[model samples]
Structures are given as structure tokens and as C-alpha cells.
Target chain A: MTAELPLQDASLVQWKPNRDRAKLIQMIVKVISGGFAAVSILTTIGIIGTLIIETAAFFSEVPIWNFLTDAKWTPLFSTQQFGIFVLISATVMIAFLSILVALPLGLLSAICLSEYASPKIRQILKPILEVLAGVPTVVYGFFALLTVTPVLQFIIEQLQIILPFIPDLKIFNALSAALVMGIMITPMVASLSEDAIYAVPQRLRDGAYALGATKRETVTAVVLPASLSGIVASIILAISRAVGETMIVSLAAGANPVLGFNPFNSVMTMTAFIANTVKGEAPHGTTAYFTLYAVGTTLFLMTLALNIFSFWFVRRFREKYD
Target chain B: MDVNEPTGGLEQSPEFVQDLEGRYRLDAIFEFATWAATAIAIGVLAWLLISVLIDGLGTLDWQFITSFPSRKAERAGILPALQGTILLMVVVATFSFPLGVGAAIYLEEFATDNWFTRVVEILIGNLAGVPSIIYGLLGLTVFLRLFSDITQGPTILSGGLTLTLLILPVVIVATRESLRAVPDSTRLAGFALGANRWQVVWSHVLPAAMPGVMTGMILALSRAIGDTATLLVTGAAAFIPFSPDGFLSRYTALPIQIYNWASRPQAEFHNLAASGIIVLMAVLLIMNTTAVVLRNKFQQRS
Candidate 1:
């Protein structure tokens, strides 16, 4: 059984979608990309908008000068002096303490991981550190509250006998939160610093070794210095993370915003204040609701500046291996 | 200047004598410190896991998993919280996956070496560094407050949207890296085969980049799961007795519920919080492991 074939028309061109289809796709891609970029920019703009609107409302109700200079930070109970310095102080205090702990531990861990530890060991340990990072900050909050606070209380009590200057530190204060936050951000700094250190070429290490330098000398003089920018950036990023941590400080550090720098005392951070007051279901146009936005704006600017600065520094100082 | 050197040259000195008394004491100390650091790192992980495991092991049961929270704390279950968390992840993934992939594709395939695109890239990178709490603020103000009357602010939708923002940068970075790893020749081949630009991207490029995208999605979802602050601010109700009814329904995630329970004065509540931690950890591990395995399989296949 033979099938009959139809004759082709010689005059007509074969039907094909115009090459403009590519251009059409390109246009679609362009729109999509523009949309993605716009979404990001919009988020940043949204932050600014919220901050300005809320802060303006707050300033109108309670003078901006008072919010800046007043020492007190009680909005829930009274309309008097709603200064945010206390909150800023608390945030700074905790951040400073966190950086204190994180800088040493994180830098040292990075050093050990990059310069000292075997690759096999790093393979096993890096993931463990990441897992630590992966543990919910809420879990860290509990750890701070349930475990570390009691331990601190016990230590402070024990130390009081030997040292009269211990100030009778409370367990749930800036110190504990800082310590926990430090622990939380250490893995991040360490991992990134290790990457930076490793990026320093092998020739630098070999050069140091060839000059009769010990392994420690090679790391300290050659690798560490070479990776300094990265290490700094890593530390800065860690500090930013530490500053921005919420649940840990909010849960562990007591919610009393004070303008003092005593690590022993309970102090509320900017994040904690935002978290607490925002939860109270404030009247929409009220000063309290606007204060959340103001605080958020402050936090946003602080973090944004840190990130931009760190990225710039890292990029500028990054060693060109090739 | 030569502390390790003996009265004669250190090379001529007895190896045992040098070993016993050496400046490498600092080296030993350094090694010991490194080991200590490793031990401490491991110890913290163990401490966290054990704290949760010891407290929650017996209480974690089918009933606990399936039941709703009761006014009577003892009779309460995490069913509502668990369900909310799962639903929130679904919603977050729904938004994040496409947005992340699209951003990644544009940066990798379509973007040229231009100032505007560079600025966009920088902005995305900067956004990634913004704190999750800040994202919470953004979410609360934009998604919740702006649409509160419309969507009744603090719904699962708002929370999910906030989390999508939190994870978007991470997903973009991962997806872009994966897409960049794909060879340029494949796109050329597709184009040569009479494929349109979209066809080349959607058909050839994306399939090659799928594993990476999936891996990034897993990571982004994992991050979303662990995040509580943004969700909390976005209006995850402190106590939800039942799973959310819809997108606009109030929600409570495991982390938030855990944070709530842990903050309470009751010891039983603390135990429940620990149990929640165990559940959270398990979920995170599963998600990450799956991503890693999938990535490995894809790498092998490719």
C-alpha cells in the first residue's frame, strides 16, 4: 500500500515566526529585569517612607529635640520625655560586648581554620559551624535566658566574694545578650575570614617558609596581613549581625531602656523596643506606632551603611590572585 | 633572637631536649587553643541539641504533632503552629522561587557591563546584608500596614511576603552563581537551532540551572523556616489555636511559638520550647540535606 504525497507549492515561503520574536523576548526580559530591580529599590524606598512618615508623626506630637536629648524612654506608661538614646545606648552596649566576644573568637577561629586545621577537619567542622548559624535565633534566645543567664547569675554571685567591684551584675542584662550574640555571629565571621585567608596565594606562604619562618610566622606575617581587608570586612559583617540580632536581646536582655553603659544592668535595644511596642496594637496615627517606624529607619540606615562600607573595603583591598 | 637554639646550634642539640624545651610551646598552646575552639564549637552544638532532646524527647509524640494548642498548657499541642509554619513556607516559596530565578537569569544572561545594571546588582547585594528584623519592619509597614484594612494586617500572607524579602537575596546569589556556571556555548547552540531568546533561556539554560535554583530554593526556605523576628513583626499571632484558614488568616510559626513558650515562666512551657527547637532543627536538617543531595546528584549528572 503506497501513500500518495502532495506536491509542494514553489511560490510560497515557508511559515516561520519573525526574528523579531527574539527581540520580543529581549523586551520581556528587560521588563522582568527592570521589575526585579524595581522591587528591590521599592523595598528600600518603603523603609524610608515608613520611617519618614512615622518619625514625622512622632516629631510632630513629641518634639524631635526631646526624642534625641531626653534621657527617659517610657512610651507605654507616660507621654513624658520619649528619648531614644536609652534604646540606642542599650543597642550599642550589647553590640560592643558582642563585638568584643565575636572579634577574638571569630578571628581566632578563622585563623585556626584557615592556617592551622587540616582540610579534612575543616570539612567536618565548617558544616557544624553553619549548623550553629542555622539554629534559630529564638533557640539562642532560650539558650541565653535559660542556660546562660542562670550561669551568669551563679558566676556573679560566686565572684562577689573575691572582687568587690563586680557591681552585683544581674544575670539578664546586656552582657549575656552580647555573649550569646557573639556566639551566634562567630561562625559567620570565621567562615568568611577563612575564605579570605585561603584566598591569599600559596606563594606567599611558601615565601615565608623559604625565609626560615615558622608556620605561625607565615600565617601571622604573610597570610593574615594579606587577608586583613577580608578579615576586617568579616568582622564588620559580624558586628552588623550582632547589632541587628533581635530575639536574643529582646528575650534575654530585660526591656528597660536606659542611657547608661553598664553591662551588668538590664537595657532594652532598638530592636527589642520595636518588637515590643509594635506588638501592642498601637493606634494607627499615634506617636507610638510612628516610633516603631522611626526606630526601624534608624536600624535600617545603620545596617545599610555598614554593609556598603564593608563591601567597598573588601572589594578595594581584595588580593588579585590571577 | 634565637630562643629555640641551644648553647650550640639547635640542629646540633639533642632532638629530645629541644622537644622538651622549645618555643613551639606557643605552637602547642596554639594547637591546644584551636582544638579548644573546635571543641567549644562542637560543644555548643551538642549543648543545644541535647538541651532540646533531653527536654522534648518524651513529649514529642503524634498527639503533640497533630493536636491544637489548649488553654490548658498541659493539654496544648503544636498542630496549629506546625501547620502555619508549613503553609508559610509554601507561600514564601511561591513568591521567592520565581522572583529569585528571574533576578538571577537577568543578572547572569541578560545584564550587560553597564552602570545602571551594576547599581542594581549592588543594591541587591546590599539588600542581602540588611537584617531580617529590618525586613520585618519593611514587611509590617508595607505589606501589613499598607494593606491592613484590605488584608487585615498580620496575616500569613504578610508574614510570607516579609520572609520572601528576607530570603530573596540569598536565592538570587545562589541562582546567579549556578546560572553563571552554565556554559555560554549551550545558549549559542540553542540560538543556532532556531530557538528564540526566551526559548533558549527557558528551555536550555534553565534546565541546566534547575538544580542550582532548586538548591537555592531549599536554602531560602530553610532560612525562612528558622526566621521568627520578621514573621513575628509581620503579625504572626503569639497564640493561634488552629491552623490558618487562608492567606489572610493569622498564623504562628514553630520558632515564634517556641520563643513564646520559652519566654514564659513555666518549666513545662520551656520543655515545649525545647521540643519546638528539636522539630525546627529536624526540619532544617532535612531541608539542607535534601538540597545538598540534590545538588550532588545534579553535579554528577552534569
Candidate 2:
């Protein structure tokens, strides 16, 4: 084409290749990528859609109020009861117990990593601490059932001798579940909190030290406050994890879906209920089967709400720091 | 800088009724407690593995790994369940890896910082936090019902789809990190050579990011392999005799199979569960090592 055209100026007689093939490839790539994005969004929509439909079926069969407030949860027996409060109560109790045990230990571990330990020590210990996360929950369940429970029983037996004045001083109940849940979530809380604490400006620590404050005082007074939001978020995330945990409670916390406040007595959690039902010989579409959906919906909502709250917290905290 | 001089009170008291001996010494107490905490944390790993091995090692053998499950725990082998698990993983990886990586690449390379994209990012992050059980319910309703026409009942395909959703966010995030690591100048240089955006990305970005993508997929797959709750809800049967012939076949993963056997009252079943756990642990260890090695190898090159 250049040769056929008359050259008005010799300097303008240059040739470049057409990019039709490259442009076509670009269009294909764009479509493919756009398709992938669609799939991701669609999948999430599918999840939310499914949960609502099944949960709606569950609510229609068992009234929302009954599911919320009913004390007994015996969907498997002849005398069927559909109260979910027992499950929620147990879940909350175990979660609370776990937080009680985990929060202090997790916080202390964070402090050690961020404030006390040298960088060399921090690098070595962090991954080791995280190894706890790699251990399967079922294994933890076995430990809690076979080992932790017996140890707790021994302690309770001893405590019963001296604390005879205190009724229900035995340990193989809510307390044990909480203790193990805390252990399960400790890695998450500690690692996240450590990151938050470490994110606090070094200048803040320096200023506190410059004022003749001890390292301990500086950490507690300055760094802790500075990283308070992140620390709270970490704790909330840990709580969420504990609440959603299954195997630990299923194995160690026992399967009686009793609504009670006593830590020493056996109780059931929402997760434990679902696991129990799934293990049972219940036919699909039965009222019993629907119970699992309702439990799942509740558990999903609880975790989602917590996660959303934490996300907001982290965002706000980042804005302030940045 | 002014500093305080050392106090003489401790010297005067000598070794008799020292502050460290008689009273609560904060430093010593904290140090001791920290060490105790560290010990407990490490002790968990050791305790779990040791106990599981002690109980499960005797029951675990080549026959046990390859045999079909029976009413009697000792007679049962894990052949069907093992096959099902392998099939499920392959399907999950096949579907999830490409789409997840593509979405990640789009977000990193193409998407602008706008409200819609931001929302997508936020949704993905939130999805990552959702419990595995919720994914199970979704599978029960969506895949099991919507795809019932395809499978007719609960099937391995449903379980794979459910696991895919569970791990999608993870793979996307990992893929995005890898894509981001590619130098911008590399893309620019390709573009300067009159190559279109696709050519630049395909020939330069993806190749450079392959190791990272592979590492992330391995990590995500390892997580899926260990997951039992979602598969359990998605209708993994307790007994799968033969390997899965197709997506519609009823499936059983090692974890669930082990759980079924473990929950039984028989002592032999308990040993079998331990054996199952060991196999699961071995798979996990291999996956973790691969991730480490790939990450390091690519990191050195970059």
C-alpha cells in the first residue's frame, strides 16, 4: 500500500505493521476476564439465595418465635420439639467461656511478640505459635474429649473437696468447652492482635519512653490505646470463629441440647446440633433436616455480622492511622 | 540523658527475705508465665499427633487404605472414600483455579478504583469470613436443587461446587497478590513493542505469576481437602464402595469417612480414625511444603 501511494515527502515513507490480531486477542482476553468476575459475583449470589430459600422453608414449618425462644430441641425423638434457644444458649455460653480463656492469653501473646520479644525471637516464635492453627479441629476434639476432659474432671474433683460450699464446682461442662474453644481460637486472635499492635507508630512508644515510662507502662497506656480498634476487631473475629467452631463442642461439650446457664452441666451448641442431626438417620426434607438449615442460617448471620463489624473497625482504624 | 542511680536497699537486705523470694516479683512471674504459655502452645501440636498416632498406627495398613468400608470397622477399607476425595479435589481445582485466577487478574490489571469494583472487593472479603457450614447449606439448596435435574440427587458434583465457593475468595486473593508482584515496567515494555494488552499480560504477566498462582491453589486445595463439614452437609454418604464414576456419584472424603468410623463406639473404629487422620496430615504437610518451596523459589527470582 505504501509502495502504491505517491510519496509527497521522502521523510514520510515509513511502514508499521497492523495490530488487528493483537486487538482481537485483547478483546477475547477482556471478555474472558469479565466472565470470571461475573462467576465470582454469581456464586456469592447463589449462596445467599440458597440459604434464604431453605431457611424460609424452615421458618414456615416452625414459627420464627418458637425457633428463637423454645427451650427444648428434640427434633429426632417421637415428641418433637423445635426450640432453638437451647442451641443458641449453649453456643453463646461456650463462646463466652472460650473468649474468657482466650482473650487474656491471646493479648499476652500479642504483647510478647510486639513489645517484649526481640525481633529475632519474634520471627522464630510467630510461626511456631501459628502451628497451632494447622492442627485439625477434630484432633483437638479428641484431645478435649479423651485428655482435657479427664484433666478437668480431676481438677473439678479436687475443687469439690475444698469448694464444697460452692455447688456445681465440676468442670466437664461449659467451662471445658470454653477452655478448648479458646485454645482453638488463640492463634487467630494472637496473630491478628500482634499485627495490630506492631502497626502502632514507633514514635508513640518512643514518646512514652522519653517521658520516663517503663516498657510495660508504655505498652499498656500508649500502644494498647493506639491499637485498641484493631485489638477489638481481632477479639471479635476470634469470638466469631469460636461461635462457628463445630468439632470441639460436638466431641467434648456433649450432645444434650439442654438450655441451662450452669458451666458444669452438659449443654449443646448450634453447631453441635447441626453436626448431630447430620450424623443422625434423618430423611431429607423432614422437619429435622430443616432444623440444620435454620441453625446454619443463624450461624451464618452471626458470623457475617461479626465479620462486617470487624471490617468496619479495621477500615476506621486504618483511616485514623494513615 | 539523666539516669537514676542503682538503689542500695537490695544490697542492704542481702539474700534474706528478698523481694524476689518473699513477695510477688512481677518480672519473674511474667517471664515464667510466658514460658509456660509457649510450652502449652507447642505442647498442643505434639499432644495431638502423638495421641492420634498411638491410637491409629496399628489399624493403618495398605489394605486399610485400599479396602471398602463395612459394618465392622476392622473389615472396612477406605478405597471408595479415597477415590471420591481425589475426584472431588480434581474437579474443584479444575473449576476454581482458572476462574479465580482470571477474576484476580482482571481486578489487578483491568478494573479501575470505582465504587462497583470496591463493592466487589468488599463482598469477596466478607465471603472469606463466612463459616464453612453456611457454604454447606448453600450447596444443599442451590447445587442440590438447581442441578438436581443433572445429578438427580445429592452428588460429588454438588460437593465440589460447594467447596469451590468455599475456596474461591482464597484463590482470588492469592492470585491477585502474585499478579501485583509483576513489575509494571514489564507490562509497559510489552505494550511499547506494539503488543496489545492481552499479549502483554499473557506473555509477560501470567508466566511471571505462575508460581505464585500455583502456590495459592495448593494452599486453597489443602484447606478444601481437610474440610468435612461442607461435604457432610452436601450429602457425602457414609459408604462409597467404588471410586466415583462421575460427578453424580455419591462421595465420601477421608475426613468424613474417618469421622464416621471415629464416632462409632468400637475401639477398632477409633484406631481407624487415627489412621485416617495420619493420611490427612501427610497430605496437608506435603501441600504446605510445596507452598513454601514455590513461594521461596519465585521470591528469589523476583
Candidate 3:
């Protein structure tokens, strides 16, 4: 028994070292993963730092006031003007127009999918709708340029005969770009809004029904109100996407930067300007090169504001049914 | 009032009956309107697909897939662009999968509740909302300028790195969701057997979460494959007559080539663009289908 006890003690001593090694390995794994996690934070810093550095360089050469207030945006021409409003106005116009097309359609689709569609129908239809979202924006740009633009031109031509006041649609018009962009974002809006609507407790709907409310009345008066924050957040996010959308506007919306709100006119958006500028060579340290960062900074700030607002709105207004 | 009557005296009033009928009719109309909205959305998708097919299907031949860009639209092929896209996907997958999964594992399995973890969570959410194009600018300054020696200038490596950053947030979010779905009981069981944290995660939790992680990875890669603006900003060449041979080789992707072709005024170029769309969509469809299948299979398992 004494000899057996010595052997057991020896085995226990051996196991202790192996366990300690395992503990060390686990600690190393955690540290490595924490390093990987830090990469995301580093990436955020890189984006902001890069934008700020280049933007500061650009602002040094071009006054901040001129960059903000100038009406002309001919950075490529010999006579360069840096009034950013030209691009901003066009960006806002297209974004607003796209939302006009997307919101009602998206909201209605959400209402139908959540309130009316059966589980089976939802299983089929939801993926089909998401397919729209999955299609690349470049493809949407192609469709806008070739299919939607021509269709709009024909419609405008026909309208001209009756309305007489209707202007001829340009080959590269904001209307085609906005319409296509809207279509591209519809699935996003629908999916998010549907999730929000679906999150509304069934008991709420039952309560509305008990009060003699019709299905339409229940959706509008109860479900939509309950999910209002989510719906609005979705819309704001969609708007942010539209503002930053590049390919659709660059290819279909044209490169002419004009400070106006005419969807019929060919207008260059801030994103389009950035895309077009980068496509051509702009030497390093040149103002033209820096404009990319300048415009990019503006874009980042705008989208960031919208994103932060949406996040805040969600946290503020979320209904805790439990 | 008769006890057996379907409607009582109050309900049988003409105005009351009329109002009920009106309400029902409005409900039906509203339902139809919602259906109409959905149909319009679907109709646009169908139209986009059909139109591209009609224009591109004729142009989509073996010769078209094998050839390089040419002055004549009919002679142009997508071989280089296709190769670049595939290689880019490989590079992106190689980097983003490990990094994103590690971050997610750290957040879900290892990290204690702290300010640093909270800050990382918020940053990732914000990063996801940041536009894809902004990542391009980051790549331009960071990869193209700062790390130009390592990346070479405007090479497939740089573009791939940029895309990896762009999709990392998506991968982390997806992975975290999957990891969260894993029950704590599984971890407890592993611990009960004297397994360490790394062993538990590597041997038990990861395998359990693999289906979802795979689905997420495929989706993220698919998004990278379709991306154009980021690559454009990262300097994917407009005309790469030769296929990329290495990471340092200048490259053009399918979407970038499609954009270049679509922007050309000639009708033939538009046809080429449509064909490229077909190829791109086909890839996406395959990826999305795989994701769905993986998710469904695993769902059935657990």
C-alpha cells in the first residue's frame, strides 16, 4: 500500500504540469483573440485618421468656406471651384427621391408580410424579396443605364405629347438613377420593417381585434405605431445608403455637378464625384487627389450621423414587451 | 329579439350593417394594396433579370468567357476579370475568416464584460453601417500609400485587403449571432470533462457553430465578389488585358469590368455588361443557395 501510494503521487504530479500547460495555452489563445478583436477598433481609427489627414491637407489649399459654399465643383478643370453644395444638393435630391419611391412600397410590403401572409407564404416570399437586396449595385447601375433610362425616356416622350410642358429626359438623368436606386433598397426597407412589425407581440394585435378593429386599422393604428422606431430607423439607414451609393449614380446619374434639385437633369452626386475622380489619375499631394478624401470625409460624417441617430432611436424607443 | 337570430336588434340596424360591410371591404382593399406593392417590387426584379438575360445570354459563349478586353466589343472576354475575382475571394477568405471568427470568439466566449468589450461592440456596429466606399478611401491611404511596399501599388493584394476590412464587420456579427445560439450547457459539459477554454471552443463549440460560420463566410465572400466601388477606389485597373498571376499583379474584377463596359456608349458594350451581370448573379445565386442549404441542414440537426 505504501509503494502504491508513491506511484499515485508521481502520476498526480505529472498531471499537474500538463494542466498548467493547458492553462497557459488557454491564456495565450485569449490574448491572441483579443488582439484580433482590436483589429476592428484599429480599422475604425484608420478610416477616420486617413480621411482627416487628407481632408486637412485639402482644406489648407482650399478654404473651408469655399469648400462648403462654392457653387462650382470643377476640380478637374483648369479653373477649379470647390463649392460642395453642388454635389450635396444632387446627393440629397436623389436620396430623397429614392426614399419617396421606397418607403410606401416597403412599408406596405412589411404590413402584408407580417399581418396577412401565412407562415408558408412568408418562407417563400421573404427569400425572393431578399434576392433583390443581394443583386449587386453595379448590376443595378447597368439596369439603370440601359433599361430604366430608356424606359423613362420613352415615357417622357409620350408624356410630352399630352402635357406639352414636359421636358425631354436626358440620357443620364437623376430620375432613372433614383428609381433604380430605390428598387435596389426596397428589399432592405421591407426586410427591416418586416422584422420590426413581426416583433410586435401577437397579444397587441389580438387586443386591437377585440376592440372591433379591422385588419387594416389594426396594422396602421397598432402594429405600425408599436414598430415605428424600427421602421424609421430602417428608412434612415436606407437614406444613408442612397446618399453613399456610387455605381448607380456614377454610371446613370452622369458627372455634371449642378447645384439644383432637378431629377430630370444629369447631376453628379458626392459619391459619383469620388468614383469619377478616382477612375482618372490624380497625382499625390494634388488638390484633385485630396478632394477624394475631402468628399469622402463629408460622406462619412453624413452617414455616421444617420447611423448614430438610428441607433439612438432604437435604444430610446424599443418596446419591452416582457 | 329572437334567441336564435344570427344578429341581434342593435346589429341589424342598416347603418351598423353598412359600416361593418364598409370596414370589411376596406380591409380587403388594403390587403390587395399591400400585395400590389410586393408584386411591383418583385416585378422590378423580374424585369431586371429578364432584360439582362435577353441582352446577355446571346453574348455569353465559351469564346466570350475566355477572351480578354478588345477594341471591338464582340471580341472582348471576361477571363482576366474572372480570374481576378476568384483570386480576390481566396485572399479575402484567407484573412477575413480567421480574423473575424477570432474577434467573434473573443467577444462571445472569452471576454469579460468591460468598457473595452463594449467599445468594440459599438465600433463594430458603426463600422457595419459605414458605407462600402469609405473603406475604399481607407484602403487607398492605408494599403496603397502607407503599406505600398508590402502591398505593392494597386495590386490584387491591396484590393483584397480592402475588401476583407469591408466585410469583417458582417462576418463578426454573423459569427457572434451563431455563437450566441450555442447553449451554455455545451460549454459546461466540456468543462465537466476537464477541458480548457481553448479546447472546449476548438473541439466543441466551433464544430457546432461551423454551419452558421460557413454560411456567414460564404455570404460575406459573395458580397466581396459583387463589390465594385471599393475595388475601384483601391485601383482595380480598368483594363487588365492579362490575367493576374500573383497577389502583386494588377487586376480587374467582374463588377469593375462590368461597370467599365456598361459606361461605354456602344450598344455592344452594354450587351457585354449584361453578360457579366449574368455571371456575377449566377455566382451569387449559388452562394446564397449554399448558405440556405447549410442553415436548413444544421437547423434540422439541432
| Candidate closest to the true structure, highest DockQ | 3
Q: Which ranges of candidate 2 are over 4 A from the true structure?
A: A1-18, A164-173, A281-284, A317-322, B1-28
Prediction 1 TM-score vs. true: 0.92
lDDT of 2 by residue, B40-102 (tens): 766766777798889888988999988888887778788887788888998899999988998
How are the candidates ranked when ordered by DockQ, highest leading? 3, 1, 2
RMSD of 3: 3.1
Better of 1 and 2 by TM-score: 1
Name the better of 1 and 2 by lDDT. Answer: 1
Once all C-alphas are superposed, what RMSD does model 2 give against the true structure? Answer: 5.4
- List CA RMSD, all candidates: 4.8, 5.4, 3.1
Worst lDDT window (10 residues) for model 1 chain B?
Answer: B14-23
TM-score of chain A of 1: 0.90
Question: In candidate 1, what are the lDDT values of residues A1-322, reduced to their tens digit?
Answer: 8664333444333655677877887788878866775677677677667778777877788877887888898877665667888888888888888888777777778778777788998888888888888888998898888888888888988998898678866756888888888888888888988889888989999998897767776777788889999999988888788778899998899788888999889889999988778667676777677788777777877887888889899889877878
Give fnat, all candidates. Answer: 0.49, 0.40, 0.84
Clashes of each: 0, 2, 1
Categorize the docking of model 1: medium
**Model 2, position B232: C-alpha lDDT score:** 74
- Mind giving the per-residue lDDT tens digits that candidate 3 earns over B128-222? 98888999999999999999999999999999999999999999999998888888899999999899888999999999999999999999999
Clashing pairs in 2: B67-B77, B68-B77
What does the lDDT read for residue A320 in candidate 2?
Answer: 60
